[model samples]
Target: MNKHQTIEILLGLLGTLLIVFALGLYILNEPSRLEQAQGDILQAQLNDAMTLYAESCAVCHGLNGEGIGATPPLDSGALRTMPFDDLYKTIARGRFDTAMPAWSKDDGGPLSDYQIEELVALIQSGDWNETGDRVVNLGLAPLIPFTTDPDPVLVEAVGSLPDGATLQTAIGIYAAQCVACHGTDGLGTGIAPALNDPAVREKPADELTRTITYGNAGTLMAGWSNVLSPDDISAMVALIQRWDEVPTGVIPAPDVSIPTTAESIALGAELYSANCARCHGPEGQGRPIAPPINVKSFLSSTTDQALQQIITLGVPGTAMPAWGDRMTDAEIQAIVGFIRQWEATAPEVAQPLGQASGGGGPPWLRNAANATATANAATQPTATPTSASPSVAPSVAPSVAPSVAPYQPGAEAGTGQGGGPPWAQEQAQTSGSAPLDWRVLALAAAGLSVAFTLIASGISSLKKYR
Candidate 1:
């Protein structure tokens, strides 16, 4: 036989052996490779879903799903126990008479069914149960949260309030200044814990004042000592002290005479406005620091005696303050009278967190808004935003189709169309879903080239023999 023929046969045999070995190795590792691919796809889908949530849902539902201004909490115990399908439908169709718009492409908001599923995965994820408690401010919305410091810079920037600030004046301070996170009455909302907590009042006056001045380090709590005058800070501290006097969550009865005259009621109004309005809105619209006294159920459920006690004693663990000496019995009654007057036009506030069970607000509202705004998403189903600046509206009505291009070959591999990103486009050329593995073809081509060269050399040598 010619030398070229023998060499050719040897090359062919070597190629066959390599092919067999390669196939064997592939077969052994295929399952793990497929599992890895599946995991990657799931991860990618999750990333996309999270991005969508942040951009679309976070604005209202809260960055962490804890409710914000009138928004309900998503992590509430009631919602945690809710069925998956019901939750899906709510997210897709959206509730009427409320701010929640439909999210499904079918309904009109923006998310695809697959994306919604990922959102569900996010809601049901282990980390989602971060709410359900009013005081524990984990996963607060806006992440960093609003900080108020007494820094010279911050104080200079915001400027100072007038001197001789009264508790009523501080009420505005707590309301306009503090309620964004603390809640109206200081029960603690989704963002910050109750400054009304006895622990705060129990702390040394200097320590508390210093903490408020510098703001808490490594925490969302900012200090206001610099921005506020010593008198202003004193007024706030005094207001907080009133809450400490309350025996517990409920106020204890005392021997003070209840006032009812128009003059007394007027005085109470001013007092509530100056001292309480900051935590409870001037209009009595409860804040992160307190519960809404304007709520219909709150009025009906609570008694005059209880309200009076609250005015006199304040709720120890909460934001309510004791009036024991700061004001006369008539004055405490005046504050109660002011709250009573507000009840007449309180605007049917949503039940405070945890109390919606009988109040008819969504069960979620019972927790701070449903840990405030995002949680009640299931709860209040009734609250809405305060004429907020229009956000980048979510996907839009699902029924309307968004324009998109048709699929093409190597789209996933990123080669066919505009070739995907650099990596993806290259994948199609090599280890991709191209039907035939490119590596094998490459090996074959290399082998053929070498074989041909050898054959040509052999032929020339044979010509000499001839």
Candidate 2:
């Protein structure tokens, strides 16, 4: 009894020890799985934050966070390496002297602290190699305002400008220098504020001129004082002042001429069809993917100077590719000229008209005209009835009577009023007689004669007629 009891007790104790060991192993592995789940959740949140940052911040920070002009770069930047708390504060507060716009509520940007935290985490976690080089923290001083009064010599030079300089002339100057960042229409791009908006328009004339001449502090807007004389600055100011007054309508001075020689427009047509039809459409009516090159819209929306700039420097961070490298300046100008010519000749919305007979027919018409002609032919009366058999004709002749004559070559074809070749006369005699409109029949005969004459003339010119 003692041995049996002892054996049973020992087995129970061994089973309990094994169960405890298994529980201990499970406990040891649980934390790792939990940590892995947390890491996955964090990564997902980071991805979402990165997407928002790209849409909102990447424009200024650059696609890979390689900042341009005034906006500081973010890839492994000092700001990124800073303590999380300090980084959070700076993002919330925003730097004052630059275009590094505050993105948090306390600093006037729209992001919440939680969102900002997520963004910061994502930026910090990004590999510098994959993203870009680390931004240097030079701790450069903020741009200070001018302390000295305007130079008397400069003031006098600006004051000497004639009061009658036109805005168009001023825009030409701006296009050469300022349009890259400020945009062709004065609507700001990536790191720049819009000059066409009310905020810029409301600024005093002198302030505007000073900003243009001296440039804004801590921004990419470089001082143009070196490039442009004070007088030129004054002209620019006058132009900006008149920006509101400029008429929003088409000006007709630059009349583009289409070459009368078919070769030139024909080459242009082929080029336009191949390269531009995808976005601008076969007729230059813009699709949703691209802006309209329609004449009225083009004239109203872009100045001549602006068009030149856009062709020269493509917009950044957009699908608009630069053609300057591929196209010669003369080629660009020619293309512009062609576009202008198209606008002039295009039918107005109020007065719709088809392309002129010589101007190459409307694209849709050219594409479908042959198919439409074929369809019409199916219903038209042919020389012989398709269903009639020569053997059975006599049996059915009385019921489906058709007047026919023996075939003869040029033997006074029926109603021989229309001038046609000998082959047409033979055809008329063999086929059933049907009434044909004299005018239509005559037109067809004349057209065929002209075509054959041209063919014969071509052969003669080629010395193959003998």
Candidate 3:
């Protein structure tokens, strides 16, 4: 073949090779791409499931599904080994006469079918460890349930019983499982019925045993059968019969002393304005999205630690995100101080929280938007304060705005006041230039090489024909 024809032939072969190479790259990357997409979707699903669990399940089951005293753990091998349908049913319809409420909307619970399915998947995945890490990263406490020795006073009180050892064991169980509702003396709280009542004492041992084993249906009480053995249930029943022997003490007065300072309060105010003022009203009034934290009902009822924990963990199923992830301990404490200040004059009843008005999305989005605005503002010309000189007379502020400040590499961007979370700061620092894909570059180069060759050949062939 002539030079031009030879070139054309080479060009066609080059194009063919390029196509083959690109196809090979696609083949190699396809599985990984598919896997990555699937992983991303699964992660999103897990996050949603975690949120649901924190809101609904975490109180009864420990934060990481480790399970509280009598609550069976979701993170266990038993859950992972469970059949999908059984698991789905357990979460959806719930167990009969158990605390596991029917979560599915069909069963009159809060979650939809899809949400229940997501929870089931979460349980099956056994990813509570990672979920816990995510929660900690957000600055919330893990709230892992721990076993503590029974109160000496409680142990001493029941020591005189014939089965003192059994009663002692039952005290530990009661302290761990039932004391929250039944009180230290079993008088009962607002939520749970009094276990020390004459009516309860009058009930047959079998009836009480059945109630504890099966749980009081349609109530917050969950069956302890899975957690407590037959003997353990018997001990609890025995302890209940001798309830009068256990002395009840007066509940201690609430501690109203919340330590804070002018400086902390001031810092908290700034932080609140930047972070919380949107969802929580500007003046600590309630909003549709957030409750009135400043009102007496909230401030008086919630302890300092409780308030801190709530801020740190966030209220799941609500707009509240775990502030622990975003803020430091000092910052959170400062915010608590700021909120607590209103208690002295706080209204007894919370006024109906008003809906959010004016422009902007949720608080998180507002933070990003505000950050961008702050960055933009920093770039705009500002009145740089003039220093008084010994020799030269200074003008009363420069007539013309000084030329925009020179960009310095590694200089702090935005306000540089270190406002916002550590993550936001890290994001700001990262240039975010993704690594180059050699496979893509190679394909592009090969195509260009072939195209150049073809153009040269065509030009040569046309000249020869002319």
Candidate 4:
């Protein structure tokens, strides 16, 4: 046969095989199709049920299931976890104490057994469970304007721990909730850091417990406070501390052997901007995660030794990370000394920090958004990690206090004042970069190359024949 004829034959065979395989695949997926149809019917029923819930229940229970003030929320873990039968009983026989009325037809209410079943199905649908918040957010905020919620309550971590009296029982909680991210050995996993690391062990028990409870914000970890009881969290901390080799707990102040000379102070300022500025505020002026080191109250209260310990151990449960593992004793001391210089700058700092819009603060202390903006906008005094000049002071400014109106969520966004959170200003910097995704272009090129090769081969064969 000629090359073209052979090619046609092969194409015919390929088509035949594809048809057969397609039929087989369709037959194989019969059960799945049936299940999908069933799910669709159930979903339609859920939609109808939702309508009923919104009309009847949402008033007192909230627009969603989030209960209004005084009224209990319906989107509760208990409701999601409870057995259908138990839930049905509760719906039919409304709570005697609470405002929740009986909706069951048997109790002379409006809803029939089927409707109650539908509502039960909706609740059991897991709308408020571990991964349901995303869908919930869609229902709550479809437009999501920037000004709507500038300062959202950022959840630090997620997942729950089972209640247990002893530390041994607490391991089960870690196995179920945390083992995926942290790993069974706690040496760290791909997603999370090792729990047994010196940084984790040396943290104060209260701090560790708080971390477990709140979870870390700006990460996938959800605060387990909703799921785990205070006792459960404490138990986890105890279990974690036991893993430490040096017997976990307060790390003593390391030697402040680093001289506090001009050269050292300059180096310390540079280091603080690079390492400490992110969480501890732009320059040790504390933020939501860390308190201000430059503030009069902070400097006056904490000793140099205590500052060294804080820098090494890091305050528990907050964002302040331990420098002990990364930084030397001298480096930490230098940062401490840089912070001490601010003692003189406190009044200057506080005067600016006082509320801008007459917002009440620590009474004597002041805070204004304009001050925050000025510190942020000033190009010269800004914290420079890359270019540290001995002459230039670290321009790290205190994070706006939550109490200050300028720092409030409703404050003017992107105005250099309390515009949104600190991240808002950074948006301008991040809005540029790789305009094209090389991965996608590479894939397209690969597909085209294959097609070109096939077409060229066919033409080459035809030419040879000619």
In terms of TM-score, the best-performing candidate is 3
- List, residue by residue over 1-466, the lDDT tens digit for candidate 3: 7865876887788887887888788788878877766765666577678766754566467657887676788888988989989999988877765556667666555678888878888998748866554333332322323233455765776676676888777777876666654543454422345576666777899999998886665444656776688999999998788766654431111223334545456657877877887777666654555555655655665666457646765655678876755555456666887888888987664433332335434776445444433342353222111111101111201110111121121232222464553434544443242323776787788888778877877788789889
All candidates' lDDT scores?
0.49, 0.46, 0.60, 0.49
Off by over 4 Å in 4: 1-23, 126-466
Flag regions of model 1 displaced more than 4 Å: 1-7, 26-37, 59-87, 95-101, 108-115, 124-140, 143-466
Positional deviation of 379 in candidate 2, in angstroms?
36
Ranking by TM-score: 3, 2, 1, 4
lDDT for each residue of candidate 2 in 164-224, tens digit (9 for 90 to 100): 3445556556554554444434433322444555555677998988887666543445556
lDDT of 2: 0.46
TM-score of each candidate? 0.29, 0.35, 0.44, 0.25
Error of 1 at 397 (Å): 30
Write one digit per residue (lDDT tens) for candidate 1, span 1-466: 7876677667756666666766665676678778767755655555445555544554356545776656687656777677889888988766764545567766545578987877776666525322211011111223222222222332232223333235455554665456545543444432355666656657787877876665554333545643577777777776676643322212111222232544445556667767875665445545566655566655554555356545544544555665532544334445676677756654454435433223333443335442432332333322221111011011111101111111122222211244333323433354445433655675576567567656765776688699
Total backbone collisions for each predicted model: 65, 0, 4, 19
**Alpha-carbon lDDT of model 1:** 0.49
Candidate number with the higher TM-score (1 or 3):
3
RMSD of candidate 4 to the truth, in angstroms, is 23.2
Over 360-423, each residue of candidate 4 has an lDDT whose tens digit, in order, gives 3453332433344335334323333112211111111011011111112232212224343332
Which lDDT value does model 1 have at 241? 62
